[model samples]
Target: MAEQVQVFGFWESPFSRRVELALKLKGVEYQYFEEDLPHNKSDLLLKYNPIHKKVPVLLHHGKPIAESLVILEYIDDVWKENYPILPHHPHQRALARFWAKFIDDKVVVAVVKAAGSRGEDREKAIKEAREALETLEKEIEKSNKLFGGDDIGFVDIVGTVIAGWIPAIEECFGFQLLTTDNFPNLIKWSDQVVNHSIVNQILPPKTEIVAFMKANWKF
Candidate 1:
C-alpha cells in the first residue's frame, strides 16, 4: 500500500531533498527513482512531467505531481492526518510561503545565474545573491528558532536549502559572504536545522555537496 508513492529525483537537488524530508517527517514510504538532469532523463520522468522536463516528480497511486514545492504541498496534504506542512493558521501559512518564494526568486536563481556568468553579469548576480541572503539573516534574527518560531515546521523544511547548502557555497567559492559575525541568527538557525534528526536523513553530506558545487558551478 505504501509503495504506491513514487519519487523521481536528482542527487544534490535541494528541491528533491525538501520533498524527501517532508515524506520522511510524515512517515510516508515511497520508491525513489534517480534522474540525470540536463542530460539523460528517464522515460517515466519524461512521461510524468512532459511540460517541465525535470525531476522531483511525485507519483501517488498513479497520479503524477511535478515541481518540488508543489510536491511538498501535495505530500503534506495527502498525509495531513499526521504532519502538517502548512500552518493551520492562514496568516502563518502565507508567511511561510512568502519566504519560500523569496528564496526561490532571490537566492536560488540569483546564485545559479552568478555561478554561470562572468565579469559584470557575475558581479550583478553576486550582489543580488548577497542582498537576498541579508534578508534571510534578518528573518533569523527575529524568528529565534525555526521559521515557525518553535518546533521545525513547513517553511523550515522548504528553506532547508538555505540552511544545508549556503555555507557550502562559501567554502566552495573561498569567500566570506555568509559570515557568522554578520549573520549570527542565520548561522545559529543553520546549525539548528542541520542538527534536526529528520533533516540529517534527507540532506547530503556537506563535503560531497561542496565538491560538486566547486566542479559544476563557479561559486
Candidate 2:
C-alpha cells in the first residue's frame, strides 16, 4: 500500500514552500494543511513538531518530519528514484548541503534584516546581503543553469525566498533588494526557478504576499 502523506504549512512561508516544491517535483501526491502561525498554531503542528512548533511538518505513514531541509531530504530519500532532488554523487551532495545551509544561516538573515530593519540597520543589512548575493552570483556564473548545473536540486529548494518572497518584500518596501544590474545571474536563476511549472504552480501570488508583508513586516 502507498504511504499517506500530509504537510502542515503556512501559505506565505518560504520554508513551507520548499517542502511543497520538493514533494511536487518528486510527483508525490500529498495533502496540505495551512497553519495559522505566530498566533494560532494548530495542536497537530505542536504535536508533530514540539520543538519548533512550526509548519512544514511532513507526516508520512504517521511519522512526523520537522524542518524544511530535513523534510526535503526525507522526500528525496523516500522517493529517490522518482525525481532525485539531491545529487547521487557524495561530493556533489555535500556541496548541495553546504549551500543550502548557507542560505538558511547567512543569506536569509541578511535579506530579512535588510528588508525589515530601520534606516541605518537596513542600510548595513543591505550591504551585507548584497555581498552575499554577489558571492552567489559568482557561483551561478560558473554554472550554465542552476547551482546544481542542469536541474533544480537541494540548493534551489532552500533558495525559494528569492523566487517569490523577496520580490514581494521589495514591492512592499518600495526598494529593490535584487536586480539585473546588481546581480544578473541570481536574477536569471530566480526567474527560472519561479517560472518552472512545479514552482510557479505552488507560489503564493505576489499581491497576496505583498499585502501580508506590508501588514506584518515593520520598517
Candidate 3:
C-alpha cells in the first residue's frame, strides 16, 4: 500500500519549499496545505510541531515529521533507492549536515541582524556572514557541479533553498555579496542551483519576493 503524505507549508518560506522540492524529486505524491503563519497557524501545525509551532510539517501515513531537514532525512530514508537525497557515506552526510547547520545557526541570524540593526552592528553581521559564504566558496572552488559533489543531493537541496534569499538579503541591507569577480565559485554554484527545474517550478517571481521581503522586515 502507498503511504499517504501531506505537507503543511507556506509559499514564501524557503524551508517549506525544501520539503516540496524533496517530494517532487522523489516523485512522492503529497497533499500540500499552505499556512498563513505567525498570525494564523493551523491546529494541525500546532499538533504536529508543538515546540516550534512551525510549518513544513510532513505527515507520512499520518505520522508527523517536523523540521524541514528532519523531513528530508525521512524522505530520503523512505525512498532511498529511487532518488537518494543523502549520500550513502557517513562522512559525506556529516559535511551536508555541517553546511545546513551553519546556514541555520549563523547565516539566518546574521541576516536578521544585518537587516534590523545599523552602524557597527550591521557591519559586523555582514562580515560574519561573508566568512560563512567564503567557506562555501572555498569548498566549491575546485569541485564537482553540485554541493553533493555531483548530481543534486541533500546539500544541494539545503543550500539552494536557503540561498534564494541572498539577493534579497544583499538588497535589503544595501550590500553586494555576489559579484562577477568576487566569490566566483559561490556565484556559479548559486546560478546552477537557481536555474534547476526543481527550483524554477516552485519559486515565486523574484520581484514579488523582493517586495515581500522589504515589507516583512522589522525596520
Candidate 4:
C-alpha cells in the first residue's frame, strides 16, 4: 500500500511552512490541511497534538507527529532516498541540529519580540534581535552557499522565518531590523532561499502576509 501522508498547517505561519518545505524538498506527495487558527482549530489537530494543539502536525500512515523540527527530522529519515535534509556525518548533523535550535530559541524569539513590543521594550528587543542575527550572519558567512552547503537542509528549513516571514513582519509593523548593510551574508542567503525554485513555491505572498498580520497580530 502507498504511504498516507498529511500535513496540518496554517497559511501565514513560518513553523507550518517549515514542514511543507521539508516535505517538498524530499519530493513527498502529502495532503495539506490548513487550520483556521486562533479561533476554530480543527478537532484532528487537537487530537493529534494535545500538548500544544497547534498546526504543522504530520500524519504518516495514521501516526501523528507534532512540532515542526521533529516533523522535519522524521521526513528526512523516512524519505532517505530523496534529498538529505540533515547532514550525513554525525558531528555535522549535531551542528545542524544545534543551529536549528538556536534559530528557534534565540533568533525567532528575538525577532518576534522586536516586532511585537513597544517603547523601551521594543528597543531592547531590537538590540537582542540584531545580536542574534549578527551571530547567525557570521555562521552563514562560513557556508559556501547555504547553511546546508550547496542545497537547502535542516538549518535552512528552520530558518524559513528569516527568508520569508521576517520581511513581511517588518513591513507590516513598520520596523527596520534586517538590512543589507547590517547583515550582507544573511541577506544573500535569504535571497537565495526565498527565490529557490522549490522554496519560492511554498512561501506565501508578502501582501497576504502583511494583511494577515495587520488583522491578527497584536502589534
Candidate 5:
C-alpha cells in the first residue's frame, strides 16, 4: 500500500510552514489541512496532539506526529532516499538539530516577545532578540547562501520565521528586530531562503500575513 501522509497546520504559522517546506524539499506528496486556530481548533488536531493541541502535526499512515521539529525529523527519516533534510553525518546532524532548537527556543521566543511587549519589557526583549539574531547572523555568514550550504535543509526549514514571518511582523507591528544594518548576512540569507522556488510557493503573502497580524493583534 502507498504511504498515507497528511499535515495539519495553520496558514500563518511559521511552525506549520516548516513541515510543508521539509515535505516539499523531499518531493513528497501529502494532504494539507488548515486549522482555524486561536478560536476554533479541529477535533482531529486535539485527538492527534492531545498534549499541546497545537498545529504542524504530521499524520503518516494513520499514525500522528506532533511538534514541528519532530515532524521535520520524521519526514526526513521516512523519505531518506529523497533530498536529505538533516545531514547524513552524525556530527553534522547533531549540529543541525542544535541550531533548529536554538531558532525555536531563543530566536522565536525573543522575537515574539520583542514584537508583542511594550516599554521596558519590550526593550529587554529587543535586546535579547538582537543577541539571538546576531549569533545566527554570524553562523549564517559562514555559509554560502543558506544554513544548509547550497540547498535548504533542516536549519533552513526551521528558520522560515526569520525569512517570511518576521518581516511581516516587523512591518505590521512597527518594531524592528532584523535590519540590514545590524544583520546583513541574515538579511541576504532571508532573501535567498524566501525566494527559493519551493519555499516561496509555500509561504503566505506578506500582505495577507500583515492583515492577519493586525486583525489578531495577539503577537
Candidate 6:
C-alpha cells in the first residue's frame, strides 16, 4: 500500500514551513491541514502531538511525528532517494544537525521571544539574539550561497526563518535585527535562500506576513 501522509500546521509558522519544504524538495505528496492554533486545535493534531499540542504534526502511514526538525530527518530518511536534507558523510551529518539545533534554540527562538518583549528585558533578548546571529554570520561566511554550499540542507532548512520571518519580526518590532552592515554574509545568504526555486515557490508573501505580525504582535 502507498504511504498516507498528512501535515497539521499553521500557515505563519516557521516550523510548519520546514516540514513543507522538506516534503516539497523530496517530491512527497501529502495532505495539509492548517491549524487554528492557540485557540482551536483539531482532534487529530491534539491526538498526534499531545505533548506540545502544536501544529507541524506529521502523520506517516498513521504513525505520528512531532517537532519540525525531527520530522525533517524522518522525511529525509524515508525518502532517501532525492533532495537529501542532511549531508551523506557521518561527520557532516552530525554538524548539520548541530547547526539546525543551534538556529532553533539560539537564533530563531531568542529573536522571536525578544520581539514580543518590552523595556530592559527586550534589550537583553535583542543582545542575546545578536550574539547568536553573529555566530551564525561567521558560519555562513564559510559557505557559498548556503550553509551547505551550493544547495539547501538540514541547516539551511532550519535557517529558513532568517529569510522568511525575520523581516516581518523586524517590521512588527520596529527595529532591524539583520542588516547589511552587521550581517552582510547572512543578508546575502537570506536573499539567496528566499530566492531559491524550491523556497521561493512556497514562501508566503512578505506583505501578508508583515500584516499578520502587526495584527498579532503588541509592538
Candidate 1 per-residue C-alpha lDDT over 34-111 given as tens digits, one digit per residue, 9 for 90 to 100 = 887647998999999999888789999999999877887788788888777788888878888898889888888887
Give the alpha carbon lDDT tens digit for every residue of 20-65 in model 5: 9888888898899999987899999999999999998999999999
How does each model score on lDDT?
Answer: 0.82, 0.86, 0.80, 0.91, 0.91, 0.88
Tens digits of per-residue lDDT, candidate 2, 1-219, equal 235999999999999999999988888888888898658999999999999888889999999999998999999999989888898999989989998988887778898887778789888987887788788888889885998677888898898877788788778876676888988889999999998888898889999999888787666
**Stretches of candidate 3 exceeding 4 Å from the true structure:** 1-3
Q: Which ten residues in a row are the worst by lDDT in model 5?
A: 1-10
Clashing pairs in 6: none
Candidate 1 runs further than 4 Å off = none
| Ten contiguous residues minimizing lDDT sum, candidate 2 | 168-177
Q: Candidate 1, overall lDDT?
A: 0.82
- Summarize candidate 3's per-residue lDDT along 37-145 as a digit string, tens digits: 6479998889988999998899988999999889999999998876888888898888888887777777777776777788999889888877877777787775847
TM-score of each predicted structure versus truth: 0.92, 0.95, 0.93, 0.97, 0.96, 0.95
Question: Which prediction has the highest TM-score against the true structure?
Answer: 4
Ranking by lDDT: 4, 5, 6, 2, 1, 3
Error in Å for residue 62 of model 1: 0.7
User: Among all windows of ten consecutive residues in candidate 6, which has the lowest summed lDDT?
Assistant: 210-219
lDDT of 4 by residue, 73-156 (tens): 999999998999999999999999999999999988988898889999988988998899999999999874899999998999
lDDT of 2: 0.86
Off by over 4 Å in 4: 1-3
Clashes found in each candidate (C-alpha, N, C closer than 3 A): 0, 0, 0, 0, 0, 0
Candidate 1 collision pairs: none
Clashing pairs in 4: none
